[model samples]
Target: MDHNIILFRLYIIIALCFLIPLSLLVSIQLYSLFKSYALTYFLLNFFLNNNKVNCNNKDYDTLFILLLKQQRFFLCISSVEYLLSLRYSELDPLYMLLAYCYQNHNFCYVAEYYYLKALSCSPNNEIILSKLTQVSSKLSKHPKLYTNDGLIL
Candidate 1:
């Protein structure tokens, strides 16, 4: 009976050794996911609020960097679009962000359009010019590859 109790205790210790690390890993993942979701929600609310004029470019830049780091291109595009709908319509950076998001999604034509818009906003911007040239060449190389909606066929 004493031997059986010792074996049971050993088994419990082994189980805990495995379970503790597993539980820690799972909790870490859950916490990371929760943080990501909370940040996304906050960003959505920040962009959607009507009183955006009170916010500055630094705040937008920080949010843009965060969205990019998270690889949330759709949210980045939507947020830039909302900003453009406001007084930032002529902002070259907003156009550039939109172009980049579309390019990442393989919408080369739409990307080219926004790149051109960005270039129009800042005619001397070498980066926008280079991106436009690249997208233009891509479109030329595969003229029939994308449908009217700019999705690859």
Candidate 2:
């Protein structure tokens, strides 16, 4: 009985050690999602929810990056815009985000532009080059939103 109790206690300790961090991370992710969505709500309501916890640029950026990595382009847009407005005085766009958004929106040529711009920042990146090639190929193969006297062609 004593040996069983000792083993049970050890198992509980190990499980709690793992679960505590996992739960904390999950809660933080949930809060980040809620806070980001709150920005789209009424201004007063946004402020009310925002006042509960002040997240800095890094926190917002991390969440934004996570959303982008998840291929949640539309969701990340608000986060990117918020991060840009907060950190940059002139509000410079994140080229990667712009490329992802445009590509998702079916603006292949425009996405190619931003992807090229992003490639300039990371010249040797295979991912950026691959995305650029993909978008460029798409641009050449399909009718764009504007071409040939404002007609899709």
Candidate 3:
């Protein structure tokens, strides 16, 4: 009877350990989903607002430049999420921007992932394919580094 009680207690503890954490993970994921949806709309509005401003206006142009810079940072973070397969986060724009950064920075593996992600969304994107091809050529030339760690451009 003592053995049976101890075994039952251990089982309860194990079940709680897994079940509580799984529930928390699921809740966090759901929260992130909603947050991402909201961020998508906010980003869209930000871009739209910038576009509606007069291009010839110096103040508007300055603002636009700042916004663009911020957008690039956001894109980079998002790209990391994509590379890490953390789709729970919204990082598509960051991923696209990440491709450009990788291409220029000689991070071919990261560039490849970013390019692939962009292409996945717009399969026939000529720009993405061109970048991918360029990176691929660079990678082939330096075949000594074959791991994804080197894929980041």
Give the top-scoring candidate (lDDT): 1
Candidate 1 TM-score versus the reference = 0.69
What's the C-alpha lDDT at position 57 in model 3? 34
In the range 100-133, model 2's lDDT, one tens digit per residue, is 8879889887788878777877788778877876
Q: Write the per-residue lDDT of candidate 3 for residues 36-135, one digit (tens) a residue.
A: 5566556545544653423333433343334345455455444344334533233344456667666766778888988888888778877777777788
lDDT of 3 at 110: 83
lDDT (0-100) at residue 68 of candidate 3? 49
Off by over 4 Å in 3: 1-93, 141-153
Q: Tell me each candidate's TM-score.
A: 0.69, 0.43, 0.36
Q: What are the root-mean-square deviations of the candidates from the true structure over C-alphas? A: 7.6, 10.8, 14.2
Tens-digit lDDT string for candidate 1 (79-150): 887777777735899999999889988899899989988888889998997788778787885334567789
Cand. 3 Cα-lDDT: 0.62
